[model samples]
Target chain A: MTKSLKTVQLSHGGGGKEMDQLIKSVFFEAFNNPILCSEEDAAKLHLSGPVAFTTDSFTVAPLFFAGGNIGKLAIAGTVNDLAMMAAQPEYLSCSFIIEEGFAIDDLVTIVNSMAAELHQSGARIVCGDTKVVPKGCADGLFINTTGIGRIIYPDVSANNIVAGDAIIVSRDIGRHGATILMAREGLALESELTSDCATLWPIVEQLIAANIPIHAMRDATRGGLSAVLNEWAKASNIGIDVNESAIPVADEVKGLCELFGFEPFDLANEGTFIIALPQAIAQGAIEVMQRYGHCQQAAIIGHATSAHSGKVVLTTPWGSHRYLDLPQGELLPRIC
Target chain B: MTKSLKTVQLSHGGGGKEMDQLIKSVFFEAFNNPILCSEEDAAKLHLSGPVAFTTDSFTVAPLFFAGGNIGKLAIAGTVNDLAMMAAQPEYLSCSFIIEEGFAIDDLVTIVNSMAAELHQSGARIVCGDTKVVPKGCADGLFINTTGIGRIIYPDVSANNIVAGDAIIVSRDIGRHGATILMAREGLALESELTSDCATLWPIVEQLIAANIPIHAMRDATRGGLSAVLNEWAKASNIGIDVNESAIPVADEVKGLCELFGFEPFDLANEGTFIIALPQAIAQGAIEVMQRYGHCQQAAIIGHATSAHSGKVVLTTPWGSHRYLDLPQGELLPRIC
Candidate 1:
């Protein structure tokens, strides 16, 4: 069926027979499930207990990028949000806004990527909406994913961090932002910096199963580590002090940041996350992350402090400390 | 704070300080709620029992139409999908993709419109995402809303339409499609036509409260009445026979359809809905709709039959019958 179409036509989103065929052949075929195939206005689910709901709209430029595409980001972004809240990712609703004349092949690749990403988190795209606008009305495509899941280990929040909590980062930072920057600059083939775009549920699940006394957890997405740490400081009314040299940054990412005059700590990491926990359990958490979560670079890089509340301070390698403020102005637009 | 900005810039979506300010000053100011203001990665919801989940992406051209804007349509559309499933609209997650340089005032207006429409169903915007693309990457703005609610009256489905069930329409159809067409064609003010863009949860809640014994319920949205009837027939494996003259069509909508060489049944309706129920209580259902649902033109227009299964036959005033097929091609794009 996909072979019959070269590019998407406006009629494919006209809510007509053409639209039905397009949906059945492309979308339904990729994200097929019993609940989705029920042909109902909405998917019916038997849910009980406290649930976590999050949504994200992916408008990453270039559509295709190193290591992952917009479709993978859409699924993993929403799933990670739920996982950060100690939620077991379950159901997701996807919506696509496509431009007329988008290539059917590219769309197939994107949808297939989304289906594969969902498998990583054991989540299902139970319902979806599609809209195709005329040429120039939109870029190639924008995907919005909203997810709901049961809160397995509740009380994980940005405001839960205590003054004595240690902050641990999963893996390296800035790969996602550097990869996108490289792609946008047409330097992708010259570098090995691929996006850390992945589903974080397995890591989160392991952390929960290990009974690490987590106070707060967050993915360093937009505004990167600086944004998340600053938000945590303000939300929890505590100061966060970090050792600059202790944080992990890939060499390629650091080189890219140097070339662009950007800070690796201020760039996004799609698959990386930060956890705040008691200092006593921080090493145990890191061990679990490395041994079972597949996060070999996981390390404790900071700690919450009562002094200088509502601030994030970073101590440089030379012992000079300065505030790590929330990123200001535009670093990158449509990076994810 | 909104007065400080004339237009949205790429920085507003950079996942930085500017984006945070924009979100708090605009989105949070309008859709303020405890859950949304919690500042967590995901909104926590305590949901139980059978739940209905649906999603819709609104890329309606012109952004603002005769009766409502894209924001209102986004809210109403997802709510209607849940309502069609006999769900009590409870929570919604909204994600927006905005074009750079879009007017801040327009964004405020759209956000406020969404907040206002959400009041109709007592649903809360619990979580949301915002992305801004570079200029020309998208039109003014596009919104995707995903909703979840507990199904109050279960067993209502298209496949539940048994033979001899009465079919009823809530009110006149095609106003939404005609209004958008007029707006897009620059003929909006030439006539008094307006889109029937409204939230239908109140009407649906009333029907459920009245114990309508609804077998099937659907909003005649994109693809309109013709699509809904045909889909119901096919899903239920029953035949649907409709009286063409009995289906209400406002004079303005009819005139516009005539001018455009389109069929009223094929045009869209945002607020309008069709229902299938026991023939014995058809009049009672109409009375409930007219008196309490504010559907003054509510009337019985058809019934399900054992013959001609999987087909929708429309009886003309001339005593001729023709199959009412699902709309075949583009009638109007971005009709919402």
Candidate 2:
């Protein structure tokens, strides 16, 4: 019967026959697992040790994007939060607020992308809820994913950073923010830029296995490299000095930032992350990241300092230094 | 700076200064807890044993209702799902997707309601996220809450119902649905009706403490009593028989159901729940519910049977029997 309908109707989320059918045919089919298939009021899980819990809501416009879609971002974003805490991601709960008359084909594509992304972290979607609003009440769709994982490397924390700790970037930045701008501005045909929206669990897992002794690890998601560094500086009550030339940025992203008058440091990155560790082991960590984690562009961009506490200073290529403040106003809305 | 603006701006969700100020003043101030104040990517929790996890998204139109707002419903809905599994509501993660230009006063009121509701189950909002969409991209706001708790009574499940089990209703039904309908229709001044929106943990805790052998337990949410009963029958592969006269319904609910030509059994209940237990303990369960759960009208309305497997048969007051199939199409959208 669902095949007879081209789009999702209000009845599909009415908690009745049509709702059950849609969940079984779409969500259950894509995310088939014993825990979810049990169909209880809540999922029963066996958890122990220090558990890391986090949540994120994705309202990215144009659900479909160049490199990934909202579904992929929803999964990767929550899983990456766990990974940032040096946790082993295990379970996730997904809730969808869909608009009436959304295309069933697009829903399928999104669900399939979610299923594929889950494979990167070995996390299972255990329980979920669905609701549908009238057409004008919502955009296309919004997804909220909450995740739980066991903290394997328990010493990692933002406040743990200290003087002499080297700051490292996982990869090139600003691609995700620039890509979204391009998509929204109808400049998709002008360049081949794509969002760096990949799951970071594999890379994080390797670093943990290598005993990197990371002090802090965080994904540069919403406010990019500047946000993470500035937060760490304020949280740790220390100063951070960066060699601006060491920070990686793609040419297309740089060009777009220049054209739009946006800073690359303020742009967002879905997959890129920053790390803080002892300078003695920074080179070793970078080597492990490149050799085993496949983060070929990973580099030590900066280091913690005792001067100018609670501030982040950037050294330009011409040897001039300036404060890299936390982004103040709206950079780009719904970039995630 | 935020005091100057009466409404939320797109910059408040931009992951920068304005967003930080809003979060600190609104969410952090109300939900002040050590874990949440730690300012980490994920909250670290020590969860042991079999954990119950559930998620729900609240998109109830007319954000503020007679009895409760979306904030109260969001917390109670997810907490009830865990309580139905005989779990101790412990940690919760909340995510908000707000539309731009929404009133700031309304947002503060909603957050305060959430903080008050969390006290009902002693659950803490350990982590959360906020995202804002452009004006008209979404309704006023939507809240997603995901909860996790340790299962104390692990035997409760929808598939655990068996032959000769008594069916009980915790309280009168259809109040929440009727109340919302009345609100949407601008008839709030005509009657003194209120939504039965409440946290069910206190009642469920009393039942567990009394050692009532609960075979299956579930909240009567969307699709209402009929949906839960039908799902139980199919899951347990058993038949259920209900005496229509034994069910409880408020006068206002009955009046509204008749006016709208809708079955009371098909209307949703925010706080009411269904239980399956042995006939021998049925009277004791009702006593516990009434004395401790404050369920004045709790009653045993039906029993599970071996005949007519996988179906629910309701006996009318006039002595006629008919199948109470699941609600087929959309009854009311965005009721929760």
Interface RMSD of each: 0.7, 0.6
- Per-residue alpha-carbon lDDT of candidate 2 for residues B1-336, written as tens digits (9 for 90 to 100): 675689999999998888888888889998999999897999999988999999999999889999999999999999999999999999999999999999988998999999999999999999999999999999999999999988999999999999999999998988889999999889889999999899999999988999999999999999999999999999999999999999999999999999888898999899999999999999999998998443899999999999999999999999999999999888989999
Q: What would the per-residue lDDT of candidate 2 be over residues A1-336, giving only the tens digit for each residue?
A: 675689989998888999999899999999999999897989999998898999999999878888999999999999999999999999999999999999999999999999999999999999898898989899999999999999999999999999999999988899989999999999988889989998999888988888889999999999889889999999999999999999988999989999999999999899999999999999988888887433789999999999999999999989999999889888999987
What lDDT tens digits, residue by residue, belong to model 1 across residues A25-117? 998999999999888999999999999999999999889999999999999999999999999999999988889999999999999999999
Q: Model 1: per-residue lDDT, tens digit, B90-135? A: 9999988999899999999999999999999999999999899999
Q: Could you tell me which 10 consecutive residues in candidate 1 chain A have the lowest summed lDDT? A: A286-295
DockQ, per-model, please? 0.90, 0.91
TM-scores of the models, in the given order?
A: 0.99, 0.99
* Pairs clashing within candidate 1: none
